[model samples]
Target: MSGHGFHVHGPHDHELEHAAHGNDDFASRIAVMTAIMATVGALFGYEGGATQNDAAMFKNEAAIKKTEAANQWNFYQSKSSKQNLAELAMVLPGADAEKYKAKVARYESEKEAIKKDAEKLEAESKEWEEKSENALHQHHRWAQAMTAVQIAISLAAITLLTKKKWLQYASYGVAGIGVALAGLAWFHI
Candidate 1:
């Protein structure tokens, strides 16, 4: 019975205080870990979105190039048809035979030029397709990373709820995999 009502802690009180301190420390660790996981998850989500956008852009470019190549082929076919008509006209009666011959020569030269252009367009289209495929592959990797990070975040939440140290470790393992996948995506391999 002290006059100030300030008593010294007994052994039981000391043990309770130590346990409370430990619980607070554990809660702090969980909070810190959750925060870190959330930050990384957000970054992974953003990168996944960006990669998907890049893939879509590349795909659209490929489609455009393919359309251009198709158009060039169509033009080439039309020129070929015209050249055929000119050859037919050249075989006709002698009234305009020389003129038809000159026209046939011009059409042959035009066809040659058109063939070169169409070939160039086809090559360009193939290059675009290759680029698009590469982007898509990278996008898939990024998506996988995003998924792993999301799972890690969920596991972290569960760890907090269940107070399971094993779950926390598992969350870290999943997060590591996510980070690795993100690195792979960066290299676009």
Candidate 2:
């Protein structure tokens, strides 16, 4: 019996004890690797969530801008219709012919101003839509990176259970890919 009050039964038990010690070392190494992978995976996951939130915000803003643009276009159309009615009134031979002509000219100017404003709003709306698309694309990239990291972490867990060096290597390779993807997401590429 040793100081711990435990004794090996025979030479076979001694060999088994040595093998167990070796396995312990391997298990400790796997634990350390798993901790590192989990840390990295958590960080990437957070970034992915943030990017997804940003994408949603941008999409909402784009929708609002588009609605505003549509309203502006509708207003412009109303002005155009008023101008057309004024032109028809001018064609009538009546005491108000001169007045109608003046009204027509005023409506024309107003329509031109309204058209410019509507066009400007439409352009702005398009710009917002483009921004939303870009954010959504970035979100997808971040999500993919997060998925890779999660898969790597799962592989690491499996490697720990199986005590397989090859599986550990595969986990590390997958982790490397996850890190690369995280880098790309960080740069918004």
Candidate 3:
């Protein structure tokens, strides 16, 4: 019976052991969670940046198309004016030039409308830019949270390994790397 009796640690020893175990568990959990959060942050950042790039590209394409359409309209108006002049010279030499001038004025009005439409599209594109910035800001916050978790985990690990030289050194190495990664995230990378 004496030999079968369980070995019991004193209250202080038990408490220290418990604290070490708790720190170890907390550190491992936080490390895993930090990895997950970091991955999520990276994905969100990429998606946000891509959306912004797409919006800018769409805006450029729309502007180019609008310009081309306006130029084509101008070309048509110029050709019509030339045809009117030729007809007047051959069929009615004394016809007033104001009729041909009126066609030019209509084309000018159409150009102004096209310009306004392009401006409206650009304004909407600017709104999209703001949305993209918002998304990026959200991603930034997520990254900061993830980094904090990583640092917490590392500190917990360091505390847990305080009594074991080998484990302490290993934890230190791991914590160093985690800290470097967290720094990179915070600084935007």
Candidate 4:
């Protein structure tokens, strides 16, 4: 028994280990192919987890940016209301109309700045959302690749048990598909 937790050799692993050292060429080939497929599956699994984590982080960033954008928009609205009141003050009789006009101008400029900042933050949030979606898509691709590789390994185990040449060929085909999926993941397709 190994010291590592959750590490248990399956019956197929024992058979594969035995076949790997056996004199039968067919068994040896299947064993080697299954070993390679397992390695590829592990790598795909790792990438899938990493991409999922990245997606979560990107989504969190998008949420934060969206909140900041909302805050800026609220600030812009507040400034607009203040500007309207200042304009009304300028119309009141005996009011400091010059001071009210200057206050209105300042509020107008501030609102413009706030509007621009909010728009920029909204764009940033959208960009982060797109990034999160892409990462999720990539994670799905990696998961598919890992699934195919696991199926290939299973087929290899069956081939080893039954000594079926056709099963071996099918396992090879599935392994190729797994590699292709991994390629698609790498390319973000």
Which one wins on TM-score?
4
How close to the true structure is residue 67 of candidate 1, measured as C-alpha lDDT?
85
C-alpha RMSD of each candidate structure in angstroms: 6.2, 4.9, 9.7, 7.7
Candidate 2 local lDDT, 19-82, one digit each (tens) = 6776587778777887887888788778778877877787777777778778877887887788
Off by over 4 Å in 4: 1-22
Residue-wise C-alpha lDDT for candidate 1, range 1-189, written one tens digit per residue: 566997876779887787677766655777788788788878877877887787788778878877887887788788788888888887887758788778878878887887788788778778877887887788788888889888988888888879899998998899899989989999987
Candidate 4: clashing pairs of residues:
none
C-alpha TM-scores of all predictions: 0.83, 0.83, 0.42, 0.87
The lDDT leader among the candidates is 4
Q: Mark the regions of model 2 whose C-alpha exceeds 4 Å error after superposition.
A: 1-23
Better of 3 and 4 by TM-score: 4
lDDT on C-alpha atoms for all candidate structures: 0.82, 0.80, 0.55, 0.95
**Which lDDT tens digits does candidate 3 get at residues 82-148?**
6566545544657665775675566556656655665665566566555555545544544454454
- What does candidate 3 score on TM? 0.42
Colliding pairs, model 1: none
| lDDT of model 3 at position 89 | 50
Q: TM-score rank, highest first?
A: 4, 1, 2, 3
lDDT of 4: 0.95
Cα-based RMSD of candidate 4: 7.7
Where is the poorest 10-residue window by lDDT in model 1? 18-27
Question: Which residue pairs show collisions in model 2?
Answer: none
